[model samples]
Target: MNDWPPVRVLEAAPRWLRKVKAIILREIGSRYTGDALGYLWAYLVPLAWVLAVYVIFLLLGRRIPIDTDIGSFICSGVVPYVCSRYAVNAILRSRTAYRHILSFPTVSPNLVGGAVFALEMVNSLLIFGFLLLLNYSVFGFFEMHDPVLALWGYFLAVTSGGAFGYLMASLSTIVPALSRATPIFLRPLFYISGVFYTANELPPTLRDLFVWNPLFHGIEILRNGLFIGYESLFAMAWVPITFILVCVATGYIVQRRRLSGAPVEGDASWAI
Candidate 1:
């Protein structure tokens, strides 16, 4: 008879999935452990932001063809945009924040970022659900034109954003200057990413300027998916896939070369 397989390594694929699931749970628990509202805050924070943006834009007297009520339209774009941005930031900092954990057995650096992405996705889903409930109850904006397309867009945006975050995290680890100037670097992206408005509404000059902003493309794809009644100008699959590949490739190269561990302008960690 053939020798039986070992219990510890019964099947590599299932074991790997189990490990990833554990990591995701651990991250989520650590993040919301003592909070009274717990994960409810995740839904609240984005909702609050969306409300603020809608009021601000309303006061400013600017409008676009969102094809839905103001709240839902704002939420459709903002939820995905905020989720992607937070995921990127969290993943970018994971390596540094949990460097000690990496010393443990079976803990890969990629897992560090993956856990962050998973947690962010969870929060995003909660926000999306809340939006759906509100849309149905308040505005009757329960138009589900293409559920599959919406899911695809949301997933693609998160994946591409997370990949880019990994790339940025790796680079910042090598170049500490970036770590010190984080907010300064990301602020401009907020205005240019088409998060608050439709890309078509942007002036011709501004539109051309933002055309090269990959985040804008990703957000537009997400908006098109969420705003069911509206049509998108760009191809969803092609833009997201190309952007994801570029970010993933750059991140892989940095990881393989151990570039993230390299020294930078400052920090003793550089000497290590």
Candidate 2:
């Protein structure tokens, strides 16, 4: 007699990666199922946003401030804002939404949250790519002067978004009432962030006031990297970077405590 089949086990790193990929696929599946528009719907949202903002600015008699096209200018700012906002919402909801899966020891909320982080980052890129094509078509020019800075800025936006997500998720674990409150906190950010105008263009009094928002810094850094003519004078690189680190550290501690303090059978503890 001989062995009819062979079994192989993956090492830890590969196994972890495999699990992450499966979780990401599961997330995508659940999100798109039964939606007739499917993936096309994802691209439409950002497009509509950019179009609406651009039109609103145009109607308000806003002139193009620099040599860059208005569409590209808005894209640089809006893309990061949209990506950051989307990431925060997705990460915040994953806890209550995936509580059943977290009961398994091998699958922690950290692992699931990491998967959501990666998924949203990919979605950020796809959505950005679609907007780039649209900008090119409408404006006939698309140039990124500093790809490295561009990428770094985009990374900061998404990471900061994830960082805030963790904070909100941790809060939801305690208050429960705030579990669905991401939108209420986030809605005001849309106007304050530099999606429609640059920091320098704002009145001196207003510029100092709005610069407090880290997303404003994120957008300014992105525009500085993308447009040669724009200088993000108000963007202090340290602010958003520090914001990301602190939020993640604090949120990680809370999440770890929650995970370790509860037994596997007590699914109620897993509730956000």
Candidate 3:
């Protein structure tokens, strides 16, 4: 009569969850260093991009693409895309940089990746709030039509980024050069993903083609959610959702094939 809990159950081994929590805490402390510089960096990256794009468009004389504040409109699109790309790059690096810890039994790719995602999300949320306040303070564009949809879109962008990062990391474990090219490959998303323009405003022919971009759907979703009277005619929520699922599955398959001799990384598969 052994009164032991099953090993597969997470409740049986708290250490799995503990390791992920510890990694997340350790990341926040080490990265931030208890200083304003780290905080400034987090906010500035997205802000700077927004300002640059806004100014360029300002000179063009039609800064307000749709019926929203120029600043808020730009922030709505740029912030999510910027954060998503950052997460993708950061998570990709985490796997290689933290290879030592990942080798430990308690630590797995998914756990480390999850910890990194948690860290990036913390920063992303702070960035979003800071920009939100800035828009309200400067441009008075605080009106939100569908807050729920907006939030869901923002989460989708970041999660899709994490999914891509996971896939890249898993691929990097095999083909290192491919991971290095991720940024260059993703650069076009900024121009085409509706960061500076919405797909809804395009002509029917162009809109149909533009709507095919999953990133565009995330941007349109966030934009529609943030602004008032801006009903987006394009964007299918299921596009990005499906894209994320595919990426995650592909990443898992890649990881599994490469590390077939042992359990897939992220002990306590429930750790994710």
- Tens-digit lDDT track for model 2 on 155-243? 88778888898888886776777767778888988888877888888999888888778888888888778889888788877878999
The model with the greater TM-score, 1 or 3, is: 3
Compute the lDDT of residue 176 as modeled in candidate 2.
74
Please give each candidate's TM-score.
0.83, 0.88, 0.89
Task: Quantify all predictions' global Cα lDDT against the true fold.
Answer: 0.71, 0.80, 0.80
Per-residue error for 161 in candidate 2, Å, reads: 1.3
Cα deviation of 74, candidate 2, in Å:
1.2
Tell me the spans in candidate 2 whose CA falls farther than 4 Å from its real position. Answer: 1-10, 34-36, 259-272
lDDT of 2 at 136: 88
Residue 30 CA displacement from its true place in model 1, Å: 1.4
TM-score preference between candidates 1 and 2, better one = 2
Q: How well is each residue in 74-110 modelled by candidate 1, as lDDT tens digits?
A: 7766777777777787787777767886766566677
Model 3 RMSD in Å is 3.6
Displacement of residue 195 (Cα, Å) in model 1 is: 1.8
User: lDDT score, residue 222, model 1?
Assistant: 62
